[model samples]
Target: MQQACTGDRFFTFYLLDGFALHGFSAAVEALRLANDVAGRPVYDWLAVTADGQPAVSSCGMRIAADRSLAEERDRLLRVAPPRCIVVCGGRMAPPPDRALEAWLRLCGRNRLALGSFASGLYPLARAGLTDGRRCAVHWEHFPDFSERFFTAKARQTAFEIDGSLYTCAGGNAPFDLFLRLIEADLGTDTVNRICEIALRERLRETGERQRLPLQARLGTDNAFLIRVIEQMEANLSEPLRLTALSPASGLSRRQMERLFRREMGRTPARYYLDLRLERAHLLLLTASQPIIEIAMACGFSTASHFSRTYRERYGCTPQQTRLAETARRRAGGRGNAPEMEHERHVA
Candidate 1:
């Protein structure tokens, strides 16, 4: 239905148990700034939760909602409903939550816009909101998401908007998405003024790439190690064997191990194992693949061996790790899981 008026666009951000504080704050601040810049409320926004309780964020912060899911529905209906609803901060592979699923179905029927931040896209995908729509998701989760939902076009964009659906890569993309919203509804001038007030850099256009180049993040001068790690990362599924890596750099396997340890402080095998694990971890979180399937993709010959190695490295079995990840998100903690830190961040 067409809006009865074209005044303030209403937005409701639904917070699952464990949402990211940074992403949520970014969305709120962007809207706040846009409203300030416009010299009027361009957006009428509200944060809501399942039970009218405080939802904890991944950054150890808690947000008190304006209303519970039930109470907010009436106001949401009255306030032009939601032109768009962005869901952020939750487990990537959440099992069916009937109440939450029902609400999303209603939104789908009403054509209220939909979106997600970071791994939050998992639930939306599970709820079947993203079918037949191009979506954007954080790059870390891209592999499993691609492998499972082969048909969905998942881009490495800061954000993607396909008709009423909107998605922003988690981290800082929320800032960009809201700025775009401001520019779309209010004007560009309002967005600029808010950017100035917030002391933030000007928003990157939607087409700009989301993540910085790897060499920059690593802060490394060792060209060889960087090259080798890059190759390993790019081929996690069909990773180069130790013998294969030898020829890639014209170095003996022993020489490669020595170089990796000298520069990266880990053996080549350990580093490679970690790389595969990181990819597996992301897929486990974002895609609905069975553990066996994910294990095979990450180069594990058997699920048992994969579980054992994952436990040894991550201090938890693969199933334990997955469960902990899901629980942490549900508990609203932004706990860091094992990532393929090809550089200094990997342990």
Candidate 2:
């Protein structure tokens, strides 16, 4: 029986339509690296869709799968049940197939581990798998996920691994999650080897932040300044004036000004303008909007003002930044290309 078996650990990747292409790709590539570096196949990955059809990603790319859920059920019965199942996709709930849910329930009962990436948390929540377990979700979707499922403990972290439930913040965190998994199941030596082949910097430990660092995020150290920065980020498309933020934060304008100068090393108005410029930079890269449109969207009074400030902070005009990002995305690939390379270098 042992001789007939092909590999030890079966990793079933459930590819839901509108799955995040980057998240799934990062996971598969990480596993591939682990296998190659280990000098033996430690994991066997099989992509599966509901009806054995190919799956499409939210980014409009299509990927073929190895089997259907039904066929997988038969295979599981014949061999060892899958040791791990990874759900990958967007905001949609898990397919409302009762049989599939039942299969997962049985797998869980039998001690199989499970994980979800990005908005894939929706289905896991829908299947009642995350109830009572702490899960990490993409920050953008946390509000909606929390509202929809009150039974689970969801947070904006890089990843959460509680017992058999593993959830990662979407985007690049899958690489970290899979690397951590390799280190947990195989060994640290294997993870380091995989990292070398994948060209990834050392796998970010779970202790590292899932988001930008606090100092970089706020661009300052003052508590009040940080709060104002948070407020600006919370309302990027619709920014607030110094006067408005002062009243909202219960600080007089003079006090706010003093706090900003002491902590952020800049006036509130300048800080807020930089924030707007940052938003404009992101829009310019990801959206195909005109510079004027982006300027207006980010609350610039006029395109000329937006362009001047953008150039000062970014060392290039908004159009130039967008062009550079576009070129990088084309050369490498969509998704993993650094979103704030220009600004990071400038700052």
Q: Count the backbone clashes (under 3 Å) in each candidate.
A: 4, 0
In terms of TM-score, the best-performing candidate is: 1
Regions of candidate 1 where Cα sits further than 4 Å from its true position: 1-7, 67-79, 221-225, 242-262, 281-291, 319-347
> Across residues 1-347, which tens digit of lDDT does each residue of candidate 1 receive?
01122336767777876577778778877876676666675666667788876676655566767667777666656655777877876435445577776778788888888888877676677778887777886777777676766667788888887877888877877888888877887777777788889887777876567777767766676777777888888788787888877777777888898998887789988899998988777776665678999999988889998888887877877777777766765544545543221111100
lDDT, candidates in the order shown: 0.73, 0.73
When summed lDDT is taken over every stretch of 10 residues in candidate 1, the lowest stretch is: 338-347
State how far residue 327 of model 2 sits from its true place (Å): 26
lDDT tens digits by residue: candidate 2, 310-338: 99998998888878866644443345633
TM-score quality measure for candidate 2: 0.66
Provide the global lDDT of candidate 2 against the true structure. 0.73
- Whole-model lDDT, candidate 1? 0.73
Q: What is the lDDT of residue 39 in candidate 2?
A: 73
Candidate 2 colliding pairs = none
